[model samples]
Target: MTVMMMKVFHVLLLLNSVWTLTGGERGVSCHFGKICVFPCKFSPGDNILIHWHLTPGNVQVHSFYDNQDQLGQQDQQFKGRTSLFLDQISEGNASLKLTGVKVQDKGTYQCYTSTMEQEAKTSNINVNVKAPVQKINMRQTENLIICSSDGIYPEPHLSWSTSPPSNRTFQNQTTVQKTEELLYNINSSLTLSDREDELEYNCTINTLSDQRRASWRRRPSVEIISGEATISCSSPDTPLSGFSLVWRFNQRQMIVTKNEDDEQRVSEEWKQHVKEVSESGRLTLQHLSADHEGTYTCEVSKDGDSSITQVSLRSDPGKGNSHVVIGIVITLVVIAAVIGLVVWRRRRGSKCTKSQKVKKRENNKLEKSEDNQDEEEETKMNSS
Candidate 1:
């Protein structure tokens, strides 16, 4: 009986050792580009050694011995990125903190602890790193609107919404592509309606039961070059909502109009210059001269609701104004030169006239002296 009891005690010790070696079964979830901690604890003592290793790769992530961290053989991948709770080391806490955790960190980690009095003990933890999904793009291409998102994990769900509320669901097609890194790239497309007014389209991507979601809204915008500017009007979304859009020049006369009934009308004079009027209510003029430069009004009306936007096209007048300034400067320069010449000539003429008068007076004085001398000579001759 004593021998049998001893054998049973040995069997229990073996089972306990096996259980310790196996470590824990539950895993931890972490996000990429975040911090992860592998928890460990022991009784306070000296001559302690705690080492952490990444399994499968057998990489030594971190180690501590003689009351100090020893990284002479640390893994190159985890260099300068792993640390321990140094303050709590004396209290037997050997938790490992990893900074800037990456997708490669998704694996099993082993924390082995040894002391002078106790044998080595090992604990295991599994980490699952999740890559976040951001950067959703919405673009309009011709008659189709496409929405896409890339680099997402654990799959993502997509949904769409429109403003001004409509019961009709857009016929959308979604495609998901998986990358080599186990991430997903998703795209959704929908055909637009030939509508005049703008409609707001919203695309949303939801992850893991809506715990996280990202949405993007499409806003209509118009951009035209400076010279021969094209006055094209657009709503938030088209080929989805049919409404009437009208183009008015200087807010006075209607230059063009695209009705919801697929009818487009252009003014008689505008026909000569209208280059292309699209079904989407975009009016492009061939040559945008000064007559076309003014406040252009885009009026949209649908179901008793109307929106008007005025776009002022002011001619640059940059080169033209520069030329005018040069002409004015030249005229002023000529006028100044003419006035200076006239003043200089008048001053010269006055000085010449004054000098001539003085010369005439001197000549008259000489003639009087000659006549007086002749009379004196005659009197002397008479005396002789």
Candidate 2:
């Protein structure tokens, strides 16, 4: 009898080990404030029961039995945020759906299932919650450009790169701070190279769930010589897939917009000025006058992140001609002043020459009169 009991105990331990090996822990990643699914399954059977609990403390997260959810004992923190796949429970799907996930929900959870025909079984899942990096704010101050984003989870990394590739290394300073809600915020600054001209700067933020990038290029003011002009919305190297482009005039008036599908929409007020929009989001304006001279901004948006480019327009058909005309008038004035100076100097020289000739004639007359007087005195003395 003792040998038979030992054999039965060994069989039981072997079965338990097999169960533990098959129902090991798995991982499920979820974005913060988004829906998360914990996948589990078992052999389909009648009288199914499912219960999900937070491990280490056995806090009830969700429960189901008798073909309906039983949440009376559910933790208050998971109230209204947890649900089970009721329709698929009969098929052995015991997955739990969690909505509005928070940092507090990140931990190990146990899914307990049982049926009248089969013994109870448990599966463990580790939930990892993260907040994706989104909406990178970028700005330039002098030679320094700053890139920043907030409300991220699990921390984030920031990097800087230049277009047209530079061999010189740039100075970068980055900081990550944890918020009171256990989320993270990242800020990075890059020192721009003074020797680089028209070099595009790109900033990228990376997280476990998502990565976002933004690019900035300083453009010189556009000069429109004729009555028409074309303003490019994006750089040639910029990617346009899955992006929405919008063009605004002076930051107030919406001129045109194009979606990812290439559908274009033009504003009613700007229909007269908007000639056409190219496939690459270049805006063509016709009948452009001085009124059209202002800042034209192009905004490219995807998901929740955006990049912006601005073009300043100056329209004046006669501007170049006016400059030329002013130059010509200045040249003519200088020429006229030079001619007047030359004529004045010549007239003064002629006057001085005439005065010298008149003085010479007066000296000749005085000499002739003195000679005649001396001859008359010599003749009188000889006669006496």
Each prediction's RMSD over C-alphas, in Å, is 18.7, 12.5
- How well is each residue in 175-288 modelled by candidate 1, as lDDT tens digits? 999887667889999777555135556667767733233222233333333445565455432441488877787667888887888677889978877777665556676655
Measured with C-alpha atoms, the lDDT of residue 127 in candidate 2 is: 92
**TM-score, per-candidate, Cα-based:** 0.46, 0.68
Model 1 worst lDDT run, 10 consecutive residues: 209-218
Tell me the tens digit of each residue's lDDT in model 2 across 1-384. Answer: 354554354345434533463366899998888899999898888666677888667788998876799999999999999998877899999999999989889998888776656666778899999888868877666688788999998888888888888787889999999988789999988887875347877888988778999876656678766567888877774457778988988767999998988788999988998998876678888877778888887878888767767678995546623656688889999999999999999999999999999999999999999999999999999999
The clash count of every prediction, one per candidate, is 7, 0
Global CA lDDT computed for model 2? 0.81
Task: Give the candidate number with the greatest lDDT.
Answer: 2
Please identify model 2 stretches exceeding 4 Å from their true place: 1-22, 139-144, 167-181, 195-197, 234-243, 249-254, 286-294, 299-308, 315-384
Compared with the true structure, the alpha-carbon lDDT of candidate 1 equals 0.70
For residue 200, give model 1's deviation from the true position in Å: 4.0
In model 2, the Cα lDDT at residue 47 comes to 65
- State the TM-score for model 1: 0.46
The worst-scoring run of ten residues by lDDT in candidate 2 lies at 13-22
